[model samples]
Target: MAPTAALLLLLSLASVCFPAAAEETLVFVTVLFRHGDRSPVRAYPTDPYQESSWPQGFGQLSQEGMRQHFELGQFLRSRYGNLLNGSYDRHEISVRSTDYDRTLMSAEANLAGLYPPSGGQVFNPSLKWQPIPVHTVPQSEERLLLFPRNDCPRYTQLVNETEHTEEVLNITAEYWDFIEFVNNKTGLKNTGVDSMWGVYDTLFCESRHNMTPPDWVTPDVQQKLRVLKDFSFQIMFGIYKRVEKSRLQGGMLLGEIVKNLSKMAAPDPQQRLKLKMLSAHDTTIAALQSSLNVYSGKQPPYASCHIFELHRDDNGSASVSMFFRNDSGAAPYPVQLPGCPLRCPLEDFVRLTQPSVSQDRDKECQLPSEGRDKEILLILALSAGALLLLIALLLAVVCWRREPMAARGYQHVLNQEGGGDDS
Candidate 1:
């Protein structure tokens, strides 16, 4: 009896420590990462370095950018090797990037590190790389990943309104002198909190490349710019009516991701696709995180990745876990939805995030009065114009009918008689 009791005690301890991990299976993963570092998208008017200074011109990815993505790819391989096959399988994975040179090239460089051509796959002995397709659409048509779309007039109005909020007013008041100083140094006329990101980005790019900034850019000034730059993202995605803003901007992507997760949750005997990789901009990451209400209020660094792992437990219940890999040297940190646990149940996650998602983006993007009021005004204007036209025609007929018989007699009667006798 003592030996049997001891065995039961051992089994209980094992169960407590293991926590049914063996029953859970990792079924699908979605990875969204910012493109690697690049040159300044554009330079300020008074900047010493212009587009001509960079080898590949402005906004192009640099050598360091390629290296950063390559290392990131290697890290992903080490982390996900058990889930992915040793060699690349196109059917099991999909890679997409924004239709830009930097993102496309970053995906390519990352693929090189993730799947170094081996054995029969090696086309050339000298070169260690192989071709892999990265899909993209034209920038104008990209709605899923791009944020703060200008096509949405309501979103534009939201931004304009956000600029006038008390918080924004306070920020403006506090930074007024700093804004003036930056405008003076950068020779920019409009340098407010909303537009200061451009200046910060220019300086950050220059600093990353070891370029010497102007004497005015001390460390303190740089730090201030960085803070404002981060705040700019907040202003665009959060600050006011965040859920509505997300419904227009980031929620589209989130909705698609949730659909993918749902599809994977269904029983499929032929489920070949396991991973989806998206290569996009920092704004994409920020917008999606904001929609999830998991934004850290800091900039997503170059090559930073957000991961979603879906696991199915023994009873066929699926749960999702989120992790953000911001630093290359450190492990990814877990992210919990505002009220959900780190590993949130699939239904709970969908329910919590549904408010952020939009059923019809175009319909939701219309302003409160845009759909009914503007359309009604147009219909009324058209109806009024038509009524006025009809009234004018009737008045002309009345005037002609009211003319005296003598005035209408001679020429009119002669013409009518010449034409026909019925009148």
Candidate 2:
């Protein structure tokens, strides 16, 4: 009501309407992407193009695949130009890939686009690229990058259970005609639902390369096969107890990512890593999406990427945001974790994903004790008891033999005592 009070009120209103912009800083980022296009890993028995037909043999990255990854690198550079150094700094970023040639090469190609040589960093004047280290372990030892690890007996059991699900059975019945057609076309015997994806992959790759597919692979047939392939992909990473599957497979990677995010969120002056990149497979992406409940029920396209960005506000509150870059030409689509906002709080993100993460994947993968194992334990117990009894009997027999010697010694002592009395 007073002049000074009114002015103060107006100032407070302005501050409320337009607060000082909170300083939001990017703290850490993790990007996991499927390797770009490649030749089919293998063809069916009757396929025309075999491994030799591919320039670098089966399952190797194609020229287009290299270009796709390079473009992806460019996209990364554009997106994080401010956060990343103009040239490659080994301490700032770490790149890892599956131990497959395609994935390894894709990472290298991506690095080329992400950190092209500039200024004094150029090793060769003509070449635009500088060698940035990309790390990988052997495929057998790789758990983070590889999804649905075959070594997991529990995962295999889950797959077996999934096979009997009503959905899978119905899909199998629906695709019976297509399966028979593939068998006939490919000259393979007993081609079933599980193996049909191979046929689809071969046909799809051929079609991609402008090679004429077999006459029977008409649009309708191709479409059906595509559906089957997508279904197969779902079965591999989803379809039943998706979160449980993630605990044993994809969740391992997710846990690692969350750990890195949490570490970076902490105020650590020594923290050097700003970016972590993983070059993996489509299944890797699918497993992660399935765990996060963001899967779109289709196979991730080649060079598809899922990004986790960790940001901290001026108040030191941390949040996470996810984006999917499936299409190289377009901007990435924002992916929200189920039950959380687009920019999910770091604590909520970790809590929501806790179910998927495992404390010990290998231990979790151990199958539950079965009747056979119980029976073996019983036998071992019985055997141990019998051995103990046998040892006791042997000790008793030795004691009995010693008793006769003691009796003889007593008789000799009595005879000596009688002789002394007669004397």
Candidate 3:
């Protein structure tokens, strides 16, 4: 009995020290990138390509986008093969996208290459692919799109307050002049679509595809356009001092983005996460990287990815590392996240990313301040009340004056004279 007890005690000790294989692995990722390029998503009034110019309609992903995403999918598979089983594990991964055709379709194309039909997928002899869900919300409805740049009232208020600061107001004035100049030059609608990205996309596409600019575009005008565009892009990215100071003062979107990172990073350090993906536009990435205090002038080229690795150091302390791959470098590509060591501590990672909290807003949003109908109603009510009050006061004054016999007598004399004249 003593010998048997000793063996059981030894077995128990070994079990306590050795963790199960299932619990030993934990990995999570959040990725953001621009859509692969083709034709412009929007057109100036005189752009050569209309809805039907490309094989695909405007704003739809092109063949080039499909190929770009497929390549990305393969890269993901090569990178995460051991962690993922041959079968697609629904619980193991979650994929989300902004509800644009190009973004949604890019996710689909990427998924096809990343997790091709393996076990049951092979059963369909005809080879038609099975459906996989890529969750998305409409752009207008997307909180994620507005992330790190929340549309919340508090954030807007903060931005408004900040905008009044000398730095912000100056930039706003400077950019307005630049915007007007572009409008006059481009002969474009000068409405919502005329941003730095739009201008750059136009020039980039024109130069790449051998398309000539409209007859209105002159050589000097093109140079000026590029210069203004570069400045606008810098301001937009918070690279310029004025923009950086204003935006840093406080912002709704930036606050929300930090909150989101906290949520993702807060998940159990030991919990297993297989695959995570984000489908977003170039601007989306800019917001996220900006939240992390990283921004470059141009939007992250299409399909660029930011990678984070979570691990523990030799001291058995948890740590993290961040990498950005814009695919621009020639030899040693992909920049590391700054302030974070090549392999940073998880605590340090949180500290670096925690600047997002500075953006948290303190107010709610009901509606945009410019509600025309509401303003009209208020104006009408005020006008009617004022007119009624004026009429009443005029009547009261007339009655008071009439109490004096002179006014009454003068009216009577005028009436008699008018009657004689009529006769």
Candidate 4:
């Protein structure tokens, strides 16, 4: 090979392999994380422990959850300390959480670790924490961070179809006995592979809290349940048609994140936000990762975080980097977009993700025209059948009235003939 050609090849490889560290600067960061450890959302009917057994009741954050989010906050501060101001600035950072108590409290706990009361910002000498605003909307109203939105009819149809797929059918058949055993043990009539997660979640939480589970919930049972739980996540977000499922469910959030990144990249002086933190459920992370085609095929652990870092080069070129931190003790894992470089250019990132993001969600969520047309045809057929039945009943009634009139006329003639014979 010519020396010039080799040199050019090296430069091209360098650009793809190395981040433009010297020239690149972090302009904005979006950190999405699952709420930390919490009590079980609910218990099976036959479970020994109920909501009252938990100190904070079911589905609420526990002390350990607080510690986890606090540590995660500290990690975020260390990672983006240079970008974020040392003190809490509402304008510089925005935090949003699901309306659930666990998520809202997790955000608050994280903010404490990210920005402790410093210097003049301290209102009380005894407390090191300062109040930071964490915004939220009702679960029904939230579309940006929630997963498997129930309002989309097409998405629901996809889910129903996914349950009947061969892969799912075989799995369910393989575990039929086990599922029935759980049904008998838990007194849950609706125990199925798709809903096995609730059982696992309840047992896992109990085990974590040192509460003894039933004898049937052995280590092996726990492990198997874990596998099914993870598979449930896949069924919800992938399994049959992942991309289409993502476009309906996770794409909403992905579109919003991209929009924010685009806004940050724009040459707008009013773009003051530096960090956007979202505290949500494991399902949220799973859905987003599925849309990105990077889901790890496991349930997102408590306090697991996904980061989107937007960087700008000295030449004003923008790129996006993704990282997943599932293990608290380990550094975050760098996620390379399937078809893009590790440091994906902003334009390429948007283009590659376009399939997952819906331009018109409601329109796309409607049943296909063919399906709608068939439904209309069925309805019209039923209406026409009903109208014909009504006409047939009216004709039968008119014929019955003529039969009675004919009988009266025959009777009068018979009486007249009998009278003539008597005279």
- The lDDT per prediction is 0.90, 0.88, 0.60, 0.91
| lDDT of candidate 2 over 345-367, digit per residue (tens) | 99999999999999988778877
Enumerate clash totals for all models, in the order shown.
0, 0, 9, 0
Model 2 segments beyond 4 Å from truth? 1-8, 13-21, 370-423
Residues 1-423, model 4: lDDT tens digits: 999999999999999998576588899999999999999999999999999999889999999999999999999999888999988888899899989999999999999999998899999999989999999999999998888789988888899999999999999998899889888989999668989999999999998889988988888888888888999999999988899999999989999999999889865588789999999999999999999999989999999999999998777889999999998899999999899999999999999999999999887788787568878999999999999999999976774465546454666546646873222
Q: Could you tell me the C-alpha RMSD of candidate 1 in Å?
A: 6.7
Candidate 1's TM-score reads 0.86
Give the Å error, residue 317, model 3: 3.1
What's every prediction's RMSD, in angstroms? Answer: 6.7, 6.0, 12.4, 11.2
Candidate 1 off by > 4 Å: 5-22, 374-423
- The superposed Cα distance between candidate 3 and the true structure at residue 122, in angstroms, equals 1.9
Q: Would you estimate the TM-scores of all the predictions?
A: 0.86, 0.87, 0.64, 0.83
Better of 1 and 3 by TM-score: 1
* Angstrom error at residue 117, model 4: 1.0
- In candidate 1, the residue pairs with backbone N, CA or C atoms under 3 Å apart (3 or more residues apart, or in different chains) clash, namely none
TM-score, candidate number 3: 0.64
- Tell me how far the alpha carbon of residue 365 in candidate 4 is from the true structure, in angstroms, after superposition: 1.5
Clashing pairs in 3: 148-253, 148-254, 148-257, 149-253, 149-254, 150-252, 150-253, 255-359, 319-346
Local lDDT at 295 for model 2: 92
- Enumerate residue pairs that collide in model 2: none
Worst 10 residues of 2 by lDDT: 414-423
What local lDDT score does residue 24 receive in model 1, on the 0 to 100 scale? 79
